[model samples]
Structures are given as C-alpha cells and as structure tokens.
Target: MDCRRLGEAGPVVSRVAFGNSLTAGNQLADDSAVACVRAALEAGITTFDTADVYSDGRAEEVLGAALSTVPRDRVVICTKVGRGAGGGAGGLAPERIRSCLDASLKRLGTDYLDLYQAHLYDDATPLEETMRGFAEAVAAGKVRAVGVSEWAADELAEGARLAREMGVPLVSNQPQYNMLWRVIEREVIPACEPLGIGQVVWSPLAGGVLSGKYRPGAALPEGSRAVAAKGGDNSLRRWKFLQDDTLERVQRLRPLAAEAGLTLPQLALAWTLHHPTVTSAVIGASSPAQIAGNLKALDVALEPDLLVAVDEVLADSVVRDPDLTLSRMLRRPRQA
Candidate 1:
C-alpha cells in the first residue's frame, strides 16, 4: 500500500508494482481478467507493468480496461515498447517506436503513459535512433518519462548520455536483481547510482524460487511454474533452482521469516527492496490476491543479522561455477 516517488516527482507509485507479464490472458476469460485487474486495483496497487509483446497486446487491453475504472491520475501506468507485435526485430526503430506508442495508447485507452520503458536493448539498432524516439514521445507529452528494461549498465549509461545530449529524460531501468541473482551488483548499480537513474527489478524472487515452496527431496509442485515450464528453453528452467542448494538456502529463510514475523515471499521481496538502488519491485500475478500477499512486504525491513545469516547459508553454495556448464565458462565470470 505504501508509495514511492517515480524519478523526480513523476508520480507517487506503489512500492509493489502490479505486473501483467504473465496475466496477458492466454486462457483467462475477459470477465475473469477484469476481476484480476479489479482485485489488484482494489488491493491498493496503483502502478501496473505491462508489455506490448505480452499476449500480443491483449495484456495491455486488459490492463488498460482495468485501469479505466480508476481516475487516471491516481494510477501509475507503465508499459514497454521496442518489443513489437511480432517477436522478430522488436527494436526501437524510430517509426516503429512511434507506431508502437500510438498503438499502445489506443490499447491502453490513455493519452499518456506515466512510465514508458524500452522492453530491451536493440544491439542491432543505433542508440540515438532508439532514444530519439523516446525523446519524441516525451516531447509530444505522450509519455511522462522514459525507462529501459533488462539493459546492462553500459547500455543504460549510453542511453542516459544520449538522452542528455538530446535533451530528454531517462528516469528508470528494470533489471533482474535479487539477493540470489546479484549480477547487477557488480557494475549496473555503480553505473546507475550516481546518474539519477532508478532500478525497477524483475525476478526479485528468482521466478518464485525464493517463495519457499520447494523442500529437500521434494517433487516440483504439480501446478506451479516450476513443473509446467519444462518445455524447450523455458526460462523457468525446471528444477534449475536445485542446481546448487538454492532451495536449501531458501528453506533456511523460513525460520528467519518466522523470526521477523513475515512470510517467505514477503522476506524475499523485502530483501530486494532493501538495496538502495532498487526503486520498485514488480510483482506479476495470476489472480488478484497475489498482489495482497506481495504487498505484505511493504516496509518489512530485513535486519542485518538475518541478512548475515542468509549470506552465511549461501557461503558454500555455488552457481555458475566453471566446472559446471564448463563449455562457455570463458564467456562470463565464474560464480565463486
């Protein structure tokens, strides 16, 4: 229920931004989708995160239709571009950006977006061409601020510089950051910290791996993302969390959450937000009450001792070890 500033007074956005990346309604009925959005809004979640590619924009339609119920000014509307209608070549082509925004506006049923982000970096596209499109959006007052998702620190820095050179505003960046996934801690945080760019993190729960569901010698839950996402190259990486005692560390946190009077999910969310660089934690949900469970993390600060305990539990754990997945160990830093 608590809110935070989006960049410099853009809007007071919810600490826990409701997300529809998965709620894009591949199967949900239109009426059920409405209930989901209504439930999120009623639960005091004012900020919504969606993408153009999600369900081929059906997600945006549902998200927009839901937000329409509330006074527009009361909600923080965030949607992304660059990822286009089709999966191929979803970059920030200048004309493509314009068309993308115009279509999103129509789908969202809004004149402007509170926070419009680039879905991902287009290495093939010229940086200026892309950022300039965002600049155009800002100039036209169709978007309040421009942000990027899943971009590396260098990419963000370049984008910020381009925004400045072009006299545009780049306010936020979304990256996959969590205690377990601290890849950004190495360079991304340092890059954005002094530049006035904020971080909105995805997978703060490691795709629900940190939700405290798995146990030692346990089967992946029947209907959870862990079991259902076993197709070729699914990002869920079925049972991947058990690669090196991840679930063990997560289970350890249960008693730690008990001590803190919080649920494991709450503890997971709080730990991500505990970092100063994070501006908001995006919580994607299937039903409405998922937002409520996530919102319990509001203001639930993790104490240092518990954090130390977590670190100690993970001290012996190994991920990205060169010995495992050794083929491309030369490509990136080895997990120690």
Candidate 2:
C-alpha cells in the first residue's frame, strides 16, 4: 500500500487506513475481528482508526488485542475522544479530554497515540479549552498529534487558530467523504487545505452502497449492511445511500469501474483519494478478503475523464450541502 503524511505535522500513514468499528464492535465475531485486523496488516495497512464510543469501548479493546503481535512502532494508532465513554460526561471539556486520552491509551495497550482526534466538534466547550487539553496531552507524551472529526469550516478555522497559538499541530480532519458524499468539498476542504490539515475520510464507500452489492430494485442482499440495519444495527443506516435513485446511479458506474479495471468499491475509494487534501480513506472490513479487495484501490487512479463521468453519473444526487458538516450532539443515559 502507498503511504502518505497524515497532515502537515502528523506521521506518515497508509493511504488506506483500516477502520475498526465494523469488525471490533459486536457486528463481527471476536476471532473474525482479530483476523480482519491481521489481514489488514498483512495487506500493508499501517494506519488504524477507532473511536472510544464505538461499542462502548469494545472496539478499542479488540483493536488493542489484535495489534499485540505487531510491534507498536510499525503502525500508526489513531483513536478519538470527546464522545462520552462508559457513562462519563461527553464533550471537549479540558478534564474530559485528558481523562479520555488516558482511558483510550489503556484500552489500546499503548503508552501513546500516533494521533488522537476529537470524535465530533463539541460546541458546548470553548475551542481554546479543547485545544489546551490536546496541547497538554502532547506535553505529557500521551498523544503525538491532534485532529477533529465532522467539524464545520468556521469551527475548524477557530480550532486551527487555537492550536497554532498553543504550538500544537492541528494536523487532520476525519470527515465522511465518498463518491456519493461530497459534503466536505463544499467548504471543509477549502478551509482545511489552506491550514495544511489533511482529511482522513470515513465512509469512503457510502456504507457499502458504492460497492455495487445493493441493486436499485433488488431485495437487500443477505448479510449486507442493509440487512444488518434491518436487524437493528442502526449505525450503518446513517448514510442514506441505499435509496433507489442513489443505487441506480451507483449501478451506472459499473462500466466506469470496468473501464478502469477496478471494482466499483475500488473506483469509489480511488476517487476519494484523488483529491489533493485527502491523506487517507478509512475502510472497515468484516473479513480479510474485503481488506485484500480494498487494498487494490491504492493502485487504481481515475483519469480526468473518468472523474468527470463519475460526476455526470452522480449528477444532482451527490450530497454537497455544507451545512451537513455540523454534527448533532447525542444524549444518552449514562452507562451503568
């Protein structure tokens, strides 16, 4: 796999990061999850991204155990804070930031994180407070670099300003971007590129809609994410990409993928990475074979004409509203 600098100041990481939410959570069996992580390592994916809120911290536990066999320095471990873990207060409060980083480190079996990100923009806390907390983490040697996820352009600008003043490198942003999801392109990319903040995009496949497994008129395929959602796995339903129109548009891209000698999923991933500001596209796999297939995207580059054809096929269906960048604060009863 090809490697790239995570941002202006972060470590060099695999262009395709192995996301742990799917396999490490309850969605997959424990052995399968561990195997999938090993499979990613075998495929040369050196970057792993996870969040503390995922499966109420089980995701990080699984990832930690999976990485025990590999030397820590060989991989970049990127985890997130700011979403409440195990019933604690949520948000980017200074105390919460420091406490969360400590907990994440213990769960990940590491002394320090390559990158620790704010899972979402915490509007309730002062941006200065959050940046200061991150700076403190860096000072304490608990976190190497800092980043954020799903932050608006204005919020990012403010955070970047604070990080600069604190002498901390606000290196990366984790946003949802894919062939069908272009919301980040409307403003976030513009704001981030100038600040030297690279994007490590999530949902690069639109939650498997771009994989061509879900057809426009066909029934939900057995064992697919849509099926999982129907069985009450609501996480995969966030994208809303399985709609008839979107599926039809995705189906039309088959020929484009064929022309490029790639699968539809690879085409989508390659397109996301084609942008100059995207440092990595996070891919979650339920099995080792999936990782092998996704790794192929590192070699598939979409020509200019193919990129235009993608836009033409997805015309009017692409999600580009800048306002979608704001994440809603979720309130849940504290865990026992």
Candidate 3:
C-alpha cells in the first residue's frame, strides 16, 4: 500500500492500482467483484482504474457501487475515454472527450475524476483539440489530471507539449509493462521522464503468464487466463508470452522467485515497479485472495543483482522493439 505521486504535479496514489477489467463483462460475479474492491480498499489500495469501454461501461457501474461507501477523497479513481461507446467511433475530438467524461462520471457516481486518460492516441483528431478538451475538463473541475495509454514515444512528446500549452498537467501514460514486455523501457520512458509524466503500467504480470500457473508443456490450468481465452476471451492471446517458448522462460524464473521468497506474480510485479518512471502497476483479480497476493509485491523490492539476474534469464525472450509500442490503430492509416 505504498504511495507514489501520479506524476510531477498529480496527486499521490497507491503503488498498486486495483483494475476492474475482469470484474466487468460478467467475467466475475457481481458479489465477487464487490468483494474484490472491498478487499483492495481494506488493504489500503487507494487507486482504482477502469475504462468506459470496459464491459460496455458495466465495469464503471460496478466500481462506482463498490466505492460509494468510501470517502471520495480517500481514493483516486482513474478512467479512460476514446475507445468510443460500443465500437462505433471514438477519438480525442473535444465533443467525444467531453461526452465520455460526463458519462464516466455518471456511471462511477462521482463528481470528478482524479485522473482521466485517453485510452489510446487518436491519430484522427488533432492533439491540440484533445488537449483543449482535457483542459476544459480540468477547468470545470470535472477532471484533476490528464493521461494517455499505449501511446508511442513521439506521440507522447507531442501530447506533453500540447498539454503544457493548454495549461493541463499531463500526468501519466498507461502502457503495458512487465518482466517479459520491455518495449516501453527503450523509448517511452525516456520520452516521458523529462516531461514529468509517470507511468501507470497495465498487464504487469503479462496476463498471468508471469504467475507460473501456466506450465510450458502441461495442460492449461482449469481457471487460468489461457482457459478463459479458449472460452472466447481472445484478449490474452495478443501477448506472445502465452506461447510455449516464452512460457518455458517463465518457468525458469520459478527458482529465482523461490530464492526471493516471492510468488511469480510478485516477482513480475516488483520488476515493473523497479523502474523509477513507473508510478503504479495495475492488477486485476477475480477473488480477494488474488488481490491480497498481488499486493504483497508492493513490499518486496528486488536487489540490484536480482534485477540483473531477471534480465539474464529473460534475455532474448523479452519483446523490446520500439515499433511494438504502436497500437494496431496507430499502425494503420485513418480511413477517409
């Protein structure tokens, strides 16, 4: 439950953020979802992250209900925009940004968001327009800070410039980062560090691949993410870490975890937080125990030698290409 500043000028939040992606979309029962949120709060997790597009906005409703009993100032609620309502269309257009923020606030039963992020970079909408929209949100007291997720290094630099011009504190960049996924380290971190933007990293455990629950040659665990993928949840499939080759490398890390008195998930999460640029690691869970276990990483800090050992073991298995930072949307041209 250690606290860290969201960025150079943002509010301090818990080192580990409770994520609602799983709790949304009927992925977990409503009671279980509520219990998980309650557990996180009991454990002193002050930050909760969700997106409007998650479970078609059902996730925000669940999170809102869970947080209703807590004092609003005691928590930092972070949600996103630009994924669009359903799949129709979404961008950083001022209108869409304003609409999404209002809808998210209504669903979350909150008057203001501690942090409102763009789910991804909108190549279609001018960055200046998006910054102005966020600026307006801040001026109106609807949002305290602005952030973006999965944006490339160049895009982040440009966004930071516009945000400064608009008098908005662009505080965070939510990107995928973990022991096995190091793409953000090369360029994104460097770009953000100077801008005073910290990272709120997602998928810190690589969709449970770093949990060592998925054996390399054995059958997928009965209730693992791989099993969920087989049941038509293709979200985890995009990460190549699920492949046998990567799983084998993960298996090799078990010895290291044992030596450090850490679970695979803790080891993975700790590695992500080791970076100074990382403000928080977002973790999703289906049960209270899962949330409790992941929170242990906040107390476990790896030594310098152990950190090096991790890289040595994961050498060549890590995904480090800067080009990989681009989302599928960023890779393609906006249709006319």
Candidate 4:
C-alpha cells in the first residue's frame, strides 16, 4: 500500500488506515477481529484508528491485543477521546481530557499514542482549555501529536490557532467524507488547507452504501450494517443512505468501476483518496478479505473525467451542506 504524511507535523501513515470502531468486539468475534487486524498489517496498513467509547472500550483491547504481536514503532496508533471517560465525567475539559488520555493509554496498552484526537469538540469547555489539555499531554510524552474529529471549519481554525500558541502540533481532522457525502468540502477542507492539517476521512464507502451492495428494490441484505444496526445510531433509517434513489445512483457507478478495473467498493474508496488534502481513508472491516479488498484502492487512480462523471451521476443525491457537519455530541450536557 502507499503511504502519506498525516500532516505537516504528524507521522507518515499508510494511505488506508484500519478503523477498529465497528468491527472490534462488536461486528466481529475476538479472534476474527484479531485476524482482520493482522490482515491489514499483512496488506501493508500501518495506521490503526480506534476510540475509547467504541464497543464500550473493548475495541481498544481487541486492537491492542492484535498490535502487540508487532513492534510498537512499526505502526502509527491513532485513537480519540472526548465523550465521557466513564463515571459520568466527559467532554474536553482539561481534567476529562487528561483522565481519558490515561485510560485510553491503558486500554490500548501503549505508553503514547501517535495521534490523539478530540472525538468531538466540547461546546461547554473553553477551546483554550481543551487545547491546553492536549498540549500538556504532548509535554508529558503521552501523545505524539494532537488532532480533532467532527469539528467545524471555524472551530478548526480557532483550535489550530490555540494549539499553535500552546506549542502543540495540531495535525489532522477526522471527518465523514465519501462520494455521496461532501459536507466537509464546503468549509472544513478550505479551513484546514493553509493550517497544514490533513484529513483522515471515515465512512469513505458511506457505510457500505457506496459499495453497491444495497440494491434499490431488494430487501436489506441479511446481516448487513443496515440490518444489524437497526434502531441505533448507525441504523439505515437514521442515516438515509439506503434510500432507493441513492442506491440507484450508486448502482450507475458500477460500469465506471468496471472500466477502471476496480470493484465498486474500490471505486468508492479510491474516490476519497483522490483529494490531495486527504491523508488517509479509514477502512473498517469485519473480515480479513475486506481489508485486502480495500487495499487495492491505493493503486487505482481515477481519471479526472471519471470523477466528473461520478459527480454528474450522484448530482442531487449528494449531501454538501456544511451545516450538516456539526457533531451531534454538541447537544450533550457539560461533563463534570
């Protein structure tokens, strides 16, 4: 697989980072999750992303166990902290940040994280306080670089300015970006471009909707995320990615993928990497083969005309309003 520097100040990472958010102890069995992580390593993926709240923190345990077999220096481990750190304390308050960082370190079985991100901005905490907490982690050698996820364009600029003042290397921002989801392009990308912060995008395949597996007229596939995630945060009904119009538009891209000598999922994954500001596309997998299949995206280069064609096909089906990029966590009360 290809590699890219995460940002001007961050470590170089694989073009495709493995995301343990969904599969770790949630979608896949322990042994199976371990095997999938090992498969990512075998496929040359060196960056692994997880979060403390994923699967109630079991994701970190599963990912840590999988990475223990390899030399620590060989991989770039990235994880986020923001939600509650347990015991009812959460948000990006200085104390909460410190406590969550320590707990994440313990769960991941690592002394320091290569990339430590605020999973979501804390509306209740002062931005300086949050950046100060991350700055302290860097000073204490508990984290290599600081980053944020799902922050708005203005939030990123303000945070980046604060981090610079605090001597913190604010590097990357994690956001949901895919062929059909263009919310970040309107403001977030332009805001981060000059600041030297690159994007580590999630849901590149739009939660598998871009993979062309969800047919317009067919019943929801058995055991699919849409089926398994029913009535929850990831439920298909909540996200509306399974709508027939969207699926039909996604299906139109099949021939384009064929022409590019790639699978539908490969086309979806490759489309995300086409952006120069994208550091890596995070791929979450339920099996080893899934990781292996996505690795091919690093090699499939989409022509400019093909990209335009994609835009034309998905036209109105795309979601580009920057207002939609705000974090749902903004509604949560302040953490004590």
Candidate 5:
C-alpha cells in the first residue's frame, strides 16, 4: 500500500483508505462487509475510515470486526465523532467528545485510534473545548492524531490555534472533494495549505454519482444513493454536481480512463489526487472489487489540458461549482 503523511510528525496511512458510510450494507451482503475489510487489508489499503454516526453505529461495528482480522499495529484505524453515529450533529461538549471517542474505541475494539476525526464542525460546541478533547485523547494515548472534517477555512484555523495552545498535533482535514465537488479548493484547501495539514477528501466519487452509472434521464440504477428515498434531501446541497453536464463530462472521460487502463471511477479519483493540496482521497466501497479498483487510482495524474477539457464541460452547466459559494458560491451554514 502507498502511504501518505497526515502532515508532518503525524500518522502515515494508506493513500486509499477504506470508507464506510451508513449504507455500506447496501452494496455489500452482511458477510461481505467483513470480507471487504479483510480483502482491503490484503490488498494493502491500510487506512480504514468509519464514523460513530454511520448506520447508528452498525457500520463501526462491522468495521471493527473487519480490522480485527488483522493485527492492530499493521493497519491505521480512523473514525469520527461530533456527529452521533446515528447521523445527527451532536454538540461537542468536552464530555461528549471524550465519551464519543471512548465509545468509538470500544466499538472498534482498539486501544487507540490512529486517526480520530470530528465528523463535522460543531458550531454550538466551542472550538477550544473540542480541540482540547481530541488533544487530551492523544495525550492519554487513546488517539494517535487529531483531525477535522467538513470545516471551512476559519473553522480549520480555529482548531489549529487551539491545538497549538494545548500542545497537541492537529494533522488533517477530511472533506468531500472530487472532480465534481472541488468546492474545497476555494475555502478549505487554501486554509490547510500553510498549516501543513493533510487533506483526506471523502466522497471522492460524489456519492457514486461520478461512477458513470447515472445518465441525463435514465432510471436510477439499483443501489445508487440517488435511488434511496432520503438521499435527495440530505444531499440537495450538492445536487448540481450530478446533473446532465457532469454525466456528459464523465462520459467524455471514458477515453481518458481507457487510455489509463482504468474505470470511470478510477479516472475520477485519479483526477482528484492530481491536486497538490490533497494528501489522500477517501473512497467508500460497497464491495471488495470497488476498493481494488480505487487502489489503482493512486498517482494517476490528469494532465493540465485534460483537466481544462473536463472544466469546459462544467463551465456552462448549472451543476456544482466546487466553491460551495463559501469562497465562490453562496453560503448555507444557516441551513445546517
């Protein structure tokens, strides 16, 4: 497995991390979840991402079992707090953060988490308290490093200040970043750049919308997130990225992936890693083969002109603008 550093003096994990969302079971049979983990380990995907809020904690349970198949030190385990594994944003009180990390450790059946991330930015929870809680976890040897997710520039900066004050190392920021969701580049990416914080972008596949299965007007495929009853409302903030223009771009990229001997998903993931700001790209797979396909995307660089060609397709479309309007698009923190 190819390893990437989560900033300086922090954990180095597999570039292709195993990501499990609430619906991992949708893609894998009950037995395959564990099987996928084992397969990922054998395939050298040493970084594993799970969250307390995924499937009300069932995802974590499944992930823990899979990691248990391998010795602990050989693999890097990453899980998140702040959002209840049940899927609601939980206030990050000191006690809540501590309790959540402890519970995640217990559920994952590990003594310490290699990377413990805040699932979301809990505005209601003071940034100081949350950073201190994660720092304390590191100090207590219960966590190897601290990280955050879905945070904007200021929020990431705040965490950095607090981590420095508390003498804790804040290592990374994981966000939803893909060719289709480049919004982080405008806000989140610039913030973390100077700090030397690694960026592990989740949803590099845009919730599977970038996998070339969806079309302009075709019926949704089986197991696609868009087909889920609740997928639309939860992801409405990102609906534009899945529009006709995005699909057209994905179609155009078929030749690119074919040229690289990869699939559309591989092409998309490779395109994401081309960014200098990204440290690693988190990939969620329902099956072992999906993870296997994604692993090959590492180091796949999209040339500048090909990237420009992809953007030309997006220029006129109403699809996602990648800026989330925070820096280039409209802001919606109030909606959350």
Candidate 6:
C-alpha cells in the first residue's frame, strides 16, 4: 500500500485507512471484524480509524484486539472523540476531551493515538478550550496529532489557528467525500490546502450506493446501508442516491468502470484519492474479501478524460453546496 503524510507536520499513513465504525452492532461480529482488520494489515493498509462513539466503544475494543498481535510501530491507529451515543451529552468540552481520550486509550490498549480528532465542531464549547484540551493531550504524549471531523471551512481555519497557537499540529479533517457528495470541493479543500491539513475522507462509495449493487428499480439488497435506512424520515434525504434518477446515473458509470478495468466500488474509491488534498480514504468492510477488493483501488489510475466523463455522467446527482457541511453539523445537538 502507498503511504501519504497526513499533513506537512503529521505522521505518514497508508493511503487507504481501514475504518472500524461498523465493527459492532448488527453490522459485523467481533470475530469477523478482527479478521477484516487482519486482512487489511496483510494487504498493507497500515492506518486503522475508529471512534469512541461507534457501537458505544465496542469498535475500539475490537480494533485494539485485532492489532494486538501486530507490532505497535508497524501500524497507525486513528480515532475520534466528542460525539456521544443515544443522544446523550456530546461536544468538545475540555473535560470531555480528556476523559474520552483516556477511555479511548484504554479501549485501544495503547498509550497514545497517532491521530486524535474531534468528531464534530462543538457549537457549545469554545474552540480555544478544545484546542487547549488537544494540546494538553499532545504535551502529555497521549496523542501524536489532533484533527476534526465535519468542520466547516471557517471552523477548520479557526481551529487550525488555535491549534497553531497551542503548538499542536492540526493535521487532518475527516469528511464525507465521494462521487455523489462533492460538498467539500468548493471550500473545504481550498481552506485546508493552505493550512497543511490533509483530508481523511469517509464513505468513498457513498454508503455503498456507488458500488453499483443498488439498481435503479430493483429491491434494495439485504444488510445494505440503504436497506437499513428504509423507514427513517432522513432516509430519503440522507440517501438521495437511492432514487431511480440517481441510481440510473450511477448505472451509467459502469461502462466507465469497465473502461478502467476496475469494479464500480474500486472506481468510486479511486475517484476520491484522485484529488491532491485527500490524504486517505477510510473504507469499512464486513469481510476479508471486501478489504482486499478496496485496497485494489490504489492501483487504478483515473485518466483526465475519464474523470471529465464521470463528472458529466453524475452532474445532476452530485451534491455541491458547501453550506450542507455546516448545516449537517448544526443539526446535531452539542453538549458534554
């Protein structure tokens, strides 16, 4: 696997990060999750990303166990805090940051995290306090670098400023980036490029919608993210790609994938990594084969003409409004 630096100052990590957000709950069994992590390690993906709120910390335990046998220095472990489960308290309050960091370290069975991120921008807490909390973690050797998730361009810039003042490197920003979700392109990319903060993107396949398995008019596949969202009010809004119009556009990309000699999912991943600002694309898998298949995306080269064609094909379905990032962040309550 090819490696890339998180930013001008952060640690170098694999281009593809193995995401463990789905390790627990009904998504994946403990043993299966361990096997998938092993598969990723064997395939040369050295970066593993998890969060404290995922499955209420069970995901971190599973990931820590999976990497226990591997040498500590051989892999980069990344995780996040600030978000709470079950609508409980959640924010980047200093005390919460410290407490969550300690909890994550215990759960991961590690002394320090390579990258520790605020799961979201906390409107409730002062950014300076959050930066100080992260700086304290760095000073005490509990975290290597700090980052944020789903932060708007302005929020990120201010955090970067505060992080610099605290002498802590704000190295990464985790966001949802994919063929259908291009919200980051208009502003986030431009803002982070100058700050030396790299993007670690999630949902590169748009929650599996870009995998070409969800046909325009066919029944949703069992266990798919789409299927799981069947009755939620946010299902349609969250998964606009499930609509026939969008799925038809997605289907049109199959020929493009074939031209590149790649699977649809592989094509989707390659598209995200094509951008210069992207440091890594976090991929989650329920099986070993899924891990292996996604790793192949690194080998596929997207031509300029092919990319242009892709934009033309999905132009109507793509979400480009930059405000969506901030609006989504605002929708979540801030506490803790």
TM-score of each: 0.87, 0.93, 0.94, 0.94, 0.89, 0.93
| Model 3 weakest 10-residue run by lDDT | 228-237
Off by over 4 Å in 1: 27-29, 84-90, 227-233, 242-244, 316-336
Q: Which pairs clash (backbone N, Cα, C closer than 3 Å) in model 3?
A: none
lDDT against the true structure, per candidate, is 0.75, 0.85, 0.85, 0.87, 0.74, 0.85
Name the runs in model 5 displaced over 4 angstroms.
Answer: 25-27, 85-90, 228-237, 316-336
**Shift in Å, residue 33, candidate 3:** 0.6
What is candidate 5's lDDT per residue for 1-336, written digit by digit as tens?
Answer: 778788875788877777777445444555877877877887888888988877767778888877776788888889888764333334576788888888888888999998888877765667777787877788899998888877778878888888888988888988877776666776677788888788888877777766888776666676666665244325723546556666776677677668667788887788777787777777766667877777777757677877777676555542344445232222344455
Q: Please give, for residues 1-336, the per-residue lDDT of candidate 3 as tens digits.
A: 789888899879999999977555556877888999999999899999999988789899999999999999999999999865333344778899888889999999999999999988776777788899999999999999999999998999999998898899899999999988888888899999999999999989988888988777778777665564232236555667767888898999999988999989889998898888888999988679998887788888799889889888888888888777745435565689
Model 4, 62: alpha-carbon shift in Å?
0.3
Clashing pairs in model 5, backbone N/Cα/C closer than 3 A:
52-85, 53-84, 53-85, 183-322, 325-329, 325-330
Off by over 4 Å in 6: 85-90, 228-239, 326-336
lDDT of 4 by residue, 37-133 (tens): 8999999999999999888899999999999979999999999988554323347888888888898898888999999999887877788888989
Which ranges in model 3 have alpha carbons more than 4 Å from their true place?
84-90, 229-233, 333-336
Lowest-sum lDDT 10-residue window in model 5: 325-334
C-alpha positional error of residue 28 in candidate 1 after TM-score superposition, expressed in Å: 4.5
Report the number of the highest-lDDT candidate: 4
**Which ranges in model 4 have alpha carbons more than 4 Å from their true place?**
84-90, 229-235, 328-336
Root-mean-square deviation per candidate:
4.4, 3.5, 2.4, 3.0, 3.2, 3.0
- lDDT per residue for candidate 6 within 1-336, as digits (tens), equals 899889989989999999866554437778888888889989999999999988888889999998998888898999998876322444777788898999999999999999999887776777788899999999999999988998899999999998888899899999989999999999999999999999999889877888988888888788765554323224334647688989899999999999899989999999999998899999977679988887788987799999999999998799998878942646656688
Kindly give the number of clashing pairs for every candidate.
0, 0, 0, 0, 6, 1
